[model samples]
Target: MADGLARVREQIAAASARVGRTPEDVRLIAACKTFDADTVREAIGCEQMVFGENYVQEAKVKWPDLKDEYPHTELHLIGPLQTNKAREAVALFDAIHSLDRHSLAKALSRQCENQERHPVMFVQVNTGEERQKSGVLPGEADDFIAACRNLYGLNVAGLMCIPPAGQPPEQHFDLLAKIAARNGLSELSMGMSSDYATAVAYGATNVRVGSAIFGNRFYPPAGQ
Candidate 1:
């Protein structure tokens, strides 16, 4: 794991240099979804302070307990969030990278109003137009971002996207960068394990990596 992390870090540095940018310009968010606490702790030991999770329930189980052991780590909720879970998410996460609609934004805002701190959020754009994905369609990106910006208690930090699997990732990432540029937004969260290098070259501010860093995910038996 240590060797893998070192290699990944070197890759990130090299990719950043290739684009004429510094490594500091990109944030590598270790995606910890489906991994156990001990593995996550190992990642923390490697000085990886930013982590991304897909399931709210799983994160709730890991974050608080791990916080005492890894106090400096920042948790980002990068999953499809349910409106009913908004309050818990706002309370526990440092950021929500999948804010896809006005109602979800409003719910998060309301929850933040009572919380000690509000989480930074990004509007997830469905750049590949996947029917099963949770994101605002590309054409609706501007309106959705505008709506989020108008909401109270929510800091509209940037944008996030997951391009269709198996396709060349550069095309999707490039489109995302263009959209963000046109809207005057500075942040882009558009990379994952497989195509993160391509993402870096195309201007991804945050890359959410899981298997590339943690190895293959282990799922429990059918009934758990």
Candidate 2:
């Protein structure tokens, strides 16, 4: 685990240096989805404090005790979020990377009011316009971001994106960075384990990496 982290950090530094940016310019989000609590503890032991999870329920099960033990660790939701889970999500995640719709924005807004806990939000843009993805289409991002702020009062801190699979990711990363720049957002979360180096070149403020640090994920046998 330590070796994996070291290699990823080295890649980050090399990429950042290529563009005259320091590694500190980018935040590494260790994607911990599908991994158990014990495995996550090993990551914490390696001083990898920031993490990202996909589901609210899974995080609810594993993170409470972990967070209590490692109070400095930050957790983020980096996958599709259901409106029904808004309350628990607002409470559990330190940040959310999937604020992609007005309905979800409204739900999260209400949950924030109810819980008095406002998690940092990133508007996910479907740069590739894929039909099966969760992000707002790229063209609608401006209005959606405005609505999230003006209508719902959610602090729109940044933007997130997942480039279409098998496409040149840099183009999508460029699009995300441009939208963020025009919107006065400085944080861009648009990288993953596979292409984080290229993402850094295009000014990604945060990168979500999992397999690179932890190796391939092992899913339970169906119906276990």
Candidate 3:
């Protein structure tokens, strides 16, 4: 585990250097989906303060237990959030990276209002235009950003995206950076375990990584 974190640190340093940006400028969000608490604790010991989770239920189970142990750690919701779970998400996560639609945004806003926690949010953009992905199409990004800005209890901090698999992820990162720039947006949340370095070069403020850092996930049987 120490060796893995050391290697990840080296990669982050090199990647930051390649892009002429300080390593501190790029925040590494350790995607802890399916990883156990001990593994997350190990990451915390390695000084990884930001953790990303995919599911509300899984996070609800994990975060409460971990937060007491790692008080300074920040939790980010990096999955497609459902409207029904917005209240819990607002109460638990420090930031949400998968806010894609107006209805979800509105629900989150109301939830935030009730909780009195202004959670940072990102508008997910479907850079690859994948029909199955949960993000706004490129053409509609402007309107979405505008709508998010008007939401009272949410902070429209940036943009997030997941590029198509097997394709050069740089293309998607470049598109996201361009769109964010045109829209006067500052934050770009793109990239993952395999393509995070490319994302940094293209302008990713936050990178979500899982397998590379924590190794493969272990899932139970469907009935479990």
Quick one: best TM-score, which candidate? 2
Against the true structure, candidate 1 reaches a TM-score of 0.96
Q: Give the TM-score of candidate 2.
A: 0.98
Candidate 3 local lDDT, 90-168, one digit each (tens)? 9899999998988898999898878888888998999999988899999999888888887544698889999998898
Provide the lDDT at 184 for model 2.
95
Candidates ranked, most accurate by lDDT first: 2, 3, 1
Clashes counted in candidate 3 amount to: 0
List runs of model 1 lying over 4 Å from the truth.
Answer: none
Evaluated at residue 158, the lDDT of candidate 3 is 88
What candidate 2 gets wrong by more than 4 Å, as runs, is none
Clashing pairs in 1: none
Worst 10-residue stretch by lDDT in candidate 1? Answer: 145-154
lDDT of prediction 2: 0.95
